[model samples]
Target: MYWSVDEVDATPYFSKTMSRNRFQIIWKFLHYNDNANLDVNDKMYKVRPVLDYIVEKFKQMYQPDKNICIDEGMMLWRGRLSFRVYNPQKPVKYGIKSYILCDSATGYCFNMRPYFGEGSSLPDTMFSLLDRLSGHGYTLYMDNFYNSVALCERLLEAQTNVCGTLRKNRGEPQVIRDLVKTDLGIGDKVVRHNDKVMVVAWQDKRLVKMVTTCHQDGMQKVDVWQKGHKDKVAQFKPECVVAYKSHMNGVDKLDQNISYYPFIRRSLNWSKKFVAYLFQMCMFNAYILYRARNPGGCNTLLKFICSVVKSWTLKVHERKGSELGEQVEEEEGAGVEDGDLEDVKHTLRAPYNTDPESRLDGDLGRHKLCYLKPTSKKLRPTKRCRVCIRRGTRRETKMMCKVCCVPLHAGQCYIDYHTTVRYSVSVQG
Candidate 1:
């Protein structure tokens, strides 16, 4: 639609701001890590840097309320990937699956980890995601996928509370499991409890099983539209059920917010699509933080994103103008006669420093390692290694990063220069 010629489908703003070819070029080069430095054991190494950075930023920017929830989120990807999951229940049925921990009230994501495979146990994954919140008095709500009797007991030991729908086979009390088999009428419920856990089997339209470490066996009245009733009528529900219903939609809310104006697009590379999904998540998180700071601010997510885009686009235009002016001046200076420049002592400017993050982005441009050309009539060409010079050591190498134009030693030094934010080396004697 952005490139549509039809009057109804055309979005002039996208075309005016950036041409389709420019957008495609940017998309094609969008990357977060050097392919050469990827860890073979880690499936998400291609986008691990951005993924970890965003997750850490998400946690640091905000503290979630006591009432938080855990749920699965899906990033739509049709491309082939080893860990892609399929679930008809999710809005994006087939995609990469992620376990997300979110604030129940505001739907702010606290932490998220993409599912790798069967190698990671459920308990281990849960504990890893809740590492920061464990030992705090937070109440975590989840579905059957994560809630289990043993897990609830473990969380209670960690001083955290758990409440969610439970599967029959997930170590539920035998009494509760038997109760699930029993036939019951509307609003009928059976409850069983120990010192640390409570299990409930309630029959409304169907049998609902739940386990909780925080809620009681008490019932709460809620409005429900029955089969024969013209208007809604009051129905007795377990307190746990009511609480679960209220808080379990945190991940869902996050998904809904990003779904409206998603940054993700069709891509042959699943990692690219995943990175775009992460970017969308970061934008939503920023919106959440913005709203929190300025409660009275009326800027919606779309408006906030548009304002950001406008500011960035203006900066780009300014940068282009400055670069063009510099080029013109350089051309005029080159045309000056040698006698005219002889009176002026010109100091060579330092090399322009490129962003380190951009260096690691694995862009499509040629970035191969090649031998430096000899400046003098020497048999072998050698330049000071960029990594070694930074380490207070004077080491030279013939090999250099072709795109960066900076010499670096082969193997570890080359990988470190592209992969690490800070490359360290011990000075040799």
Candidate 2:
């Protein structure tokens, strides 16, 4: 979802045609139903209203502030169909993408851009977002991906201060103090990794450079005498000539946060897929809230309650049947016959009932096909099955599936199902 300052003020009421709450409910539904997708006509009225409300509320919360942080994440979709406007990435092969601008100072979200593929196009995408900001004097803290001379110059031109990681071999480092060439040790040295700052100079312009002015935030230079003439602590404090490296060295951690989710469903022009994303987000939000509220409480209990309530609320009515009953005519307009009547009775299968003649008989040379089982089965059962024995009644005993923990019969318990459910319970229960 996206919101602008002007849109926040206008506060448009979501039309009644949108059935589900646009902000919370639709996404919540999409979130929990792993197999479900969102369509374009999916009820978005409910979510739109809530989103409208949230924007209004946030505006009130930050009435005088307009500072925002800009970033983008791609939501991948892997399906047979896709939108002409939003094409999938060649390598990624599927999924939509979205860029979000959040308020860094106050954790409030402000803008979103749903697209097909931009996750891999970081530099260009960041430039586009900066253009949107349009000369706003905002302090944009970014990672190494946005750490380039060209990007920094563009941001500086736009009056935006980009404080991000420095490329390893691209620019000069910021020097706080100087070191004697002879005193410098070869290779690397052992030092305690703690919250301590070191004064080092940019050795190679090709190795370390910044687009910022060299003008002083503040600069101090201390005279250095022979090493034995000075205090040993001073050597470490004023001139700890450590190797200069980028601040954001943990690329793996950052990469993990830049993956796909449901928000990009609309990029594919599929409302069902998008709704599924929103639903998942809401569920994730709910789970986090519940965990925060009740540290040791049963997540299964909470989830079960939600499922029951959702099932009860969503009506699944069966249509009444009135077309031809068991009566059968011998031929077109001819009188009905006993044989034809029996055949008609056989054809009229009732709901929740199976045809009795479809069953196989062993006397007809048919038996359950028995194939040799593999020496090992990969799936395991879940711990919720154990609850069956403890509860003694099936009423409150819905076991988590061993594979997906999406609730399954306990009789077909496998090792794979067991481990999968146990892990899910531990991480998400």
Candidate 3:
């Protein structure tokens, strides 16, 4: 159960020549056999079957005491070399989009899919995760991107429950009448829904009527009035007539250590793509497996792994005076020795040994995180390779999330209050 890329890279078995900095390199070799001629897409296709293998392995490895909360997320991808896609509405760089299904309770990744270009069937972004789980009756949560009358109907057919943000301008129209005195509008038999909400204004005051499939949730019998909030007048606040189950997006789960291999990734043909995907899935699954071993801790499994890597990297320094070491020192000044370097290392360790405040507190999760912790340590050791330290600090170097490159622990990534409460319901394209 390794946590960081450094750990994965440090494994004695990997070829010495392999570049640990770019994880995609390792993935490329494992998936494509270090063959430059083979196509990347072809590798991805071959990797699909590995998913089935992972599913079997997952079932055998962990037997949950109870049904776990499963949530799905997707990443949009284009060709490897490019970052943008050709969407007239919003074009993005050519890259890969990944879809993931995570066990909310454990914050472990259960399944993942790497998408290339847009194609038919496209796994129905609305129901992609459901398709992967191969079961029903589960409560699925998503943003407005997955909202649709047809998809809702499908969920009903499967006996699965779903609660998501409603798409704007996609609701049934209501007829309301403005009566003599009150600005309130009366609708036809509106049922009582929410226990409390502010009424901003009335449309017609009288003859208020609304059509909605959600009427059964006990909202059909109350007065359906269009209320405006102080935030925005154009957008009306939703006033549910009945008490419906309020579904929220589960807390942010662990983040996967991912890398973008823009150049080589795009050149792959179908055959190579399949094979590469197989390797990608295997490695990602390995990442999830690693996280499962550690329940709660600072830094994610990915961060842990990277820490191990940094520690192991010290071993490279251990090989001082060796042929490779000499060349490294000559070619890269980072390997050069300095008298004060050791003193700096010792000073940093003193607090961990003598002072409690300097020690890691286990209460980071409770601090109400302001933003994902910075990837780079504000202060760095002067003796260590600045390049290596830079990798740890740079958003791109950490093969995890842009917000925080550290490896994932057992639970999902931390999210802010606004994102959890509001944006959780709305879907993204």
Q: Which candidate is the best by lDDT?
A: 1
- Per-residue lDDT for 256-348 in model 1, tens only? 999999888777988888888988888888889989998877478877887667776767667756664543333223323344332211211
Model 1 is weakest, by summed lDDT over 10 consecutive residues, at 342-351
Best to worst by TM-score, what's the order? 1, 3, 2
Residue pairs clashing in model 1 are none
RMSD of each: 15.6, 22.3, 22.7
- In the range 203-238, model 3's lDDT, one tens digit per residue, is 333333222223233323343334564443332223
Clash number for candidate 2: 45
Instruction: Estimate the lDDT of model 2.
Output: 0.36
Q: Please, what is the whole-model Cα lDDT of each candidate in the order they appear?
A: 0.79, 0.36, 0.37
Question: Which wins on lDDT, candidate 1 or candidate 2?
Answer: 1
Q: Regarding lDDT, does 2 or 3 come out ahead? A: 3
Question: What TM-score should be assigned to candidate 2?
Answer: 0.31
